[model samples]
Target chain A: MKRYMPLFVLPTLCAFILGFILPFIMGVGLSFCKFTTVTDAKFVGFSNYIKALQDTVFRHSFWYTALFTVVSLLVINVIAFALAMALTQKMRGTNIFRTIFFMPNLIGGIVLGYIWQLIFNGILAKYSTALALNEWYGFWGLIILVSWQQIGYMMIIYIAGLQAIPGDVLEAAQIDGATGWQRLWKVTVPMMMPSITICSFLSVTNGFKLFDQNLSLTAGEPGKMSEMMALNIYNTFYGRTGWEGVGQAKAVLFFILVVIIGVLQLRATRSKEVQQ
Target chain B: MKKKKVMPVLLAAAMTVGMFAGCGSNDAGTAGGSTQGAQGTQAADKSSGDGSVYYLNFKPEADEQWQILASEYTKETGVPVTVLTAASGEYEKTLKSEMAKTDAPTLFQVNGPVGLASWKDYCYDLSGADVTGQLTSEDFALKDGDQTLGIGYVIESYGIIYNKALLEKAGYTAADITNFASLKKVAEDITARKDELGFSAFTSAGMDGSSDWRFKTHLANLPIYYEYKADGIDNTDAIKGTYLDNYRQIWDLYINNATCDPKLLSTKTGDDAVAEFATEEAVFYQNGTWAYNDVKDLGDDNLGLLPIYIGVDGEENQGICTGTENYWCVNKNAAPEDIQATLDFMNWCVTSETGVNAMCKDMGFVIPFKSNLDSENVLVNAANDYLDAGKTPVTWNFTTMPSEEWKNGVGSALTAYAADQSDANWDAVKKAFVEGWATEAAAAK
Candidate 1:
């Protein structure tokens, strides 16, 4: 198998180098240069990085993305876990409930954003305000939208974890006079650590990487207040002429932030996992 | 074990076959493209053409007409003319990518002075070009020092597009709206009788991405235009808030007389605004000549353009905001043959019957070049009437707006102000305009 590994790995290695590694290197190089096109790039040192740091909107988006990630992680995992536990119980027609809950995940993000925008505006119109009226409105709107779209997916993972918990453990706890609540806290939760880790990591990264929904929702209306890190970088790249290098620098910073957070989260979660 | 061996062999065979197939198809595709190119050159060669014309048109709305014009020119003269239109609002990004290619466009568009500054390095001097000679007035030519960089293609105007029947029913006419005070009275009276007349004074000037440009870019032009006039300058490095009072007056009138609440403006859209005007739910809609096709069914006799009578001194001299931002620039970096081909194509567009008819009739453009055909666009006619009446048409200096980033900042500020109409909020909007412009200009430099 080891001898044949090179043949199997060659195709994927070639694709990764061509598709991801080359472009990523080029993009990193561009962050240090000033040019309209790659062919005309002129090295400009750290000026782009300096300009990117000076951008108030870019700084605001960093804190906004951090808060959003923490909030989304808590909300999505809690709701999804609750749903997963409830659905795992011997209830009539649990499949139908699960299917209905998960259906929103199938819709495209842009389409979902527009549909929710109309719904939000319709309700807000009664109060004579709108989604773009306030940054908090857009923030909360995005939270609800992302939670609605992702909860079912996380719930599926949690359900699988719940069912995998050995029946003998629950029976043994019952024989020892352990209550339902005690059994859940001691046995079920310990076993579900892996699922919780996966779900939380996913929601956190999704929160940070959000773009299309942010754009279609508020598009940083009310003075760029609700712009996430991705949208801010995009707007800087295309909206501000001659600032493409700074935008690229912002993108590189965003990539580093996401990578650091992801690795830290994985390590923290892995530490809490029980042997089971 | 047998399955694994067989699968690997099959995969290898499939990969070899796929490689061969890919090579074959690439050869075929290139073969077809070169033949088309050869045919195009043959046609150009027959008609004293030196090179083929590759036009990167900016307007998506007129894409069909441009495609027809390209094909027609190719058929007539055997010159290979290709027209590729970028989606609206994506022209700058598209042009940036396309200009990096080997076969870059011979012809492209610049919004006005600001756009010219960005592309000045690539712009061919049209001072001695035949197309420059065909231009009706040299005033429409965009100059960089002694070099003619771009020539205006079409002149368009925008203002308060009112329903003539609705205005008459309210006991008002276009002549009554000579100033801000009179225009306000007419809109107020009509809005006061909205229930009886079955139409309000103004359509919803939505602050959504689609509709906000009407206010942010066009309506904002009123104050910018007056300030430029007062300062005796065509462009400025930084603007003082001299005409913001007039801007506020006009904005206040628009929001107060509209069919939707100011808070709800963020939810509304340009399409909704157009629908309200088309369905006669509103008496006034703020838009430009391009909207003629959308609202012409309201009847040519019943539709007219009125000056945006923001309370400025000498308001009677104001006409509809009329100017050309759509200027054509040939690429100097292109091969000389291609440049000459582009020049010839532009001259033919102005002087030839087919090109003139396509631009004036099919696309509803009021060409600034010396074309014989009269434009059939009713909005153009309305603008021409204002010019004949000796009204000084307000120039669209918004084209020279510092940057798109500045526009977005102002747009966001405007939306915020619309949501909460207060002195503090308006100050923020004003700051975003004045300060944002300075910041963007410095950044652009």
Candidate 2:
């Protein structure tokens, strides 16, 4: 089996190299060069990186992305966990409720963004305001949109984790004079650490990576105030004529930030997970 | 272990199959290449009649007409023409990606000088091309040194599009408005009598992505045009903004007299403004000849084009801001055969009757070519009326606007001012306009 393992992994290994590694290497290489096209790229060294740092919009988008990620992670996980806990208990029409809660996740991101934009604009119109009128409006609108789209997905994961826990452990805790709140905080939550880690990681990364929703909803309106890291990088690449290298540099930085934060979060949460 | 061995084999076979499946599609693309053509001319050997043309069209509004025209040409000439229209506001991005493909677009567009500057290397010099001779004048051609990089395909004019019935009901006529003072009086009176008259002075100046160009690109042209004129120059590296005060005056009047709130301007879209004008909720809408089709249902007699009176001196003699941003530029990188075919096809489009009709009627375009002499669009006719009167046409100097980044910066500043209507905000807008221009120009260089 060990001798055959290499053969079994070869296909996937080839695919991973072709699809991810090659492009990533090329992307990193391109970050150091300046050219309209790949064939014409000339090495310009750290100038692109310097430009990315100097860009006020790029810096603003970093902070915006960080704030969005933190807020969305907290909001999404809390609500999703609550919904999952409720659904996991013996309840009427639990399947229907689960399906209903998860339906938004099925819709495409662009479609969700547009649908939410119309809904938000309709509501804001009453106050003689709109989603694009203010960055805060755009920010909250995105958080609401992301939560609506992702809560169901996180809830399902949480429900799976909840169901996986032994019933006897919970029953024993209850029998030992444990209150509902105490059992939830001490046993259930500690037991749900794995689920929390996954959900938090997903929501946090999703928040940072958000683009279509941000674009369709506000498109950095009220003057690029609501532009996130991904959107900022995209705008730099396509919107600015000569900033392709700088955009690539920003993208590399974004990739590093996401990876670091994702790893840190995994470590922080993984350490707290109880051994089965 | 046996099952695992079989599974790996199956997965590897599936992967091989998928690779072959992708290859199968590429084979189809080449085999079907006979049918998938563009602008009708890219084949190296023209006598074989296998020449195909791929035109990446810029105007989203004219896309349908272009598609119909391409098919019609293919049917007549036994040549295939493939027309791909980029969504509005995404042409540059689309062109960049498409041009990198093996079968790049033989025909594309450069908006103007600033756009030409970016794509100049790819542009096939049209100086000696067949279409060059067919041009009414070389004045509309964009020249980078000795090379004619692009030629204006259409001439458009933007001003105050007024609903005639609403204006007449307000007890005013076209004759009443000749300058800023008169235009102001009528708009202010109509606004003041809004309760009685049931219509406001102007439609909402939407600052949304779709409509911001109306203000940021077109309306902003008024100041740029005047400043260029006053400075006795056609284009400049850095604008002094001599007429920004006049720009502020017109913008203020627009917001103050409109039915919609100034703070709500950011939310109002171009469609909403069109609806307002079409439904007669407002008398004035600041748009261009392109909007003629959208508002034509209001009846020709009911619609009129007036100069955007921004209180510039000797402005009574000023015509509507007139010129074109769209220019046809052939890809220099394409094969010579494709280039020649593109040039021939471009000539045929302007010279042929079918092409002329489509441009003037379906697209509502005032083609700059000598072949298309007349246009039926009322706004176009109105523009001609201004030209015939010897009024100086405000050349679209905004074509030289440093870049989209600068335009966005200015747009943001303008929106902030529109929202707050403060002196400090106006100053910020001024700074974005003046200093931002120099900054962007330097960056572009």
Candidate 3:
């Protein structure tokens, strides 16, 4: 065990420090500094955080992201579960259909954004309006894009949960004269809680982390009406001069929000899981 | 039982330490590699040890030329050159990130005054070089006090480039568009039969990166041109914008009479509009001579450039949009050798006949150089004619500094007006324009 300890634990520790710990420390320090490069940072503490908290764009992004995540979370989980339930049943070419449905997730975010942009603009062309510069078009466009990309991935997870339920549970409910829907509600659903919990957690976290697609698709057109948290932080940091600290503050706030929401989601979902 | 239980915990502890050590090592390696690369860049020619030239290209159109130029320079000098071209519109942000590297490009472009100002602190000086003398004066030079930070490798001008064949085909000549009213009347007539002629009056007047040059700088010239003339001097940043109402006349005329759907203008660029003109779908495209390469293949004999006279008074004598572009400056941070090389290169480009001819051949450029700027190049010749005709040339007075706030602020306001043609939006545009200019001009550090 001692001999192999370095081999096994070394990679993860390195990953933590390199990917998370180091950058995190640097980022926190940067939130107080006003400068272009990290090394050249000039300490002007609290002002960056104050400005970040006060920014209308940052505040707007928080609300926008929250709304988007809630809406997408519900829609994605529902569609995924419905598809999972149907696919888990006896059916021909279920794997093929699953593969087909899940394929959208394989495409890169920037490419998906551009493809969706073309599709949206094509549809809007007949109406004599465009998706390129409008705000609502950007929001709905992101919604459609995210749902199309994530539903299949969540559906796969849901299928794993649905398949794990004991046949005896459903059989016992049937013997007790339960209707089909009743049996599903009493036996299958209760047993599928673990899968439902995990999928919900994943989709919710993913909604918070979203960036590339939002950037490529609309870039929050028509005065940033569709700007999300990640895009807002990026633009604030790089687009505005001397706003690095403010951008860093937004990032720290973002980290706190995601961590809180993620942990809360995990706890809530985990509590619903059946012992089995 | 105790030994067994403790095995995983012991293993995990060891793993954690190893992990941190491994990461620390990697960071040290990266930092070391960066330092070495920086040292190489600062070294002259042979000692650079895999040191190569990296260029972050803003013009996608110049990708081919850069590839050729880079390859030629490498073959000529035996210096390794790596050219990374930013697909158009990605230059500023990409360059910002790229410039922070330990192995930043030693030979990248310093395009304009605003661009120079943005990265002035990083440039190497080229002041006493032979290339410094090639310039007409300090007019095209960008300096940080005594240091010549950027040298114009090649300069360009923008105006209204027209399809003379289409004009002749429509029973008119390039000579006909002498005044604002004449230009407007002809454009409307041509646009009325856009189907028969298979063209329209103008291309998409979008306000994004490509097309905003038309609005923020070019089309706004009606107001600025008048302001420049009103004062009977050069470089007027102040404008009444009362004539901005007349600006709406030309703006409305261009937007309504254009071949493109205006709603898509937010995404359209000068490149897209020029593409339309090149394909002969639009009779007129507003852009700089930088666009000459894209259109030159259509045959220079058929292509004609008219001076921008959106609707200014005394418009008959107005010449093409007269301005300077793509100025070069040296880095204040460069080592003595690099500074010398940069100086040497600049002098070589301006004074050496080989350098000027090569620049002209590839760039089709108008140099500020007295000797070299005299070219068989008709575009440069025509630009000179505009200057010689005593027409007050409109410079890019707004770009005295590169402010993202000013660029996007002007763009945002112009975008709203382009959509609805509301006087309120125009007023908003003017407010954004004036206030943004005032703020940026004042805030420049």
Candidate 1, residues B160-271, lDDT tens digits: the string is 8989998888888888888999989988998789888878899998888898899989999989998998899988879886888788888888988999888888888999
The two-chain DockQ for each candidate, comma-separated, is 0.56, 0.55, 0.28
Colliding pairs, model 2:
B37-B81, B37-B82, B38-B53, B38-B54, B38-B81, B38-B82, B42-B52, B43-B51
Best DockQ goes to which candidate? Answer: 1
Fnat per candidate: 0.63, 0.48, 0.27
For model 1, fnat equals 0.63
lDDT of 3 by residue, B54-152 (tens): 444555655565556555555655655444565455556555555666545455565566666557767776666676776777877766678777766
Quote the B-chain TM-score, candidate 1.
0.91
RMSD of each: 3.9, 3.4, 5.3
Q: How many backbone clashes does candidate 2 have?
A: 8
lDDT of the candidates, in the order given: 0.85, 0.85, 0.70
So what's the TM-score on candidate 2? 0.93
TM-score on alpha carbons, each prediction = 0.93, 0.93, 0.86
Query: For candidate 1, what is the lDDT?
Result: 0.85
- Whole-structure CA lDDT of model 2: 0.85
Candidate order by TM-score, decreasing, is 2, 1, 3
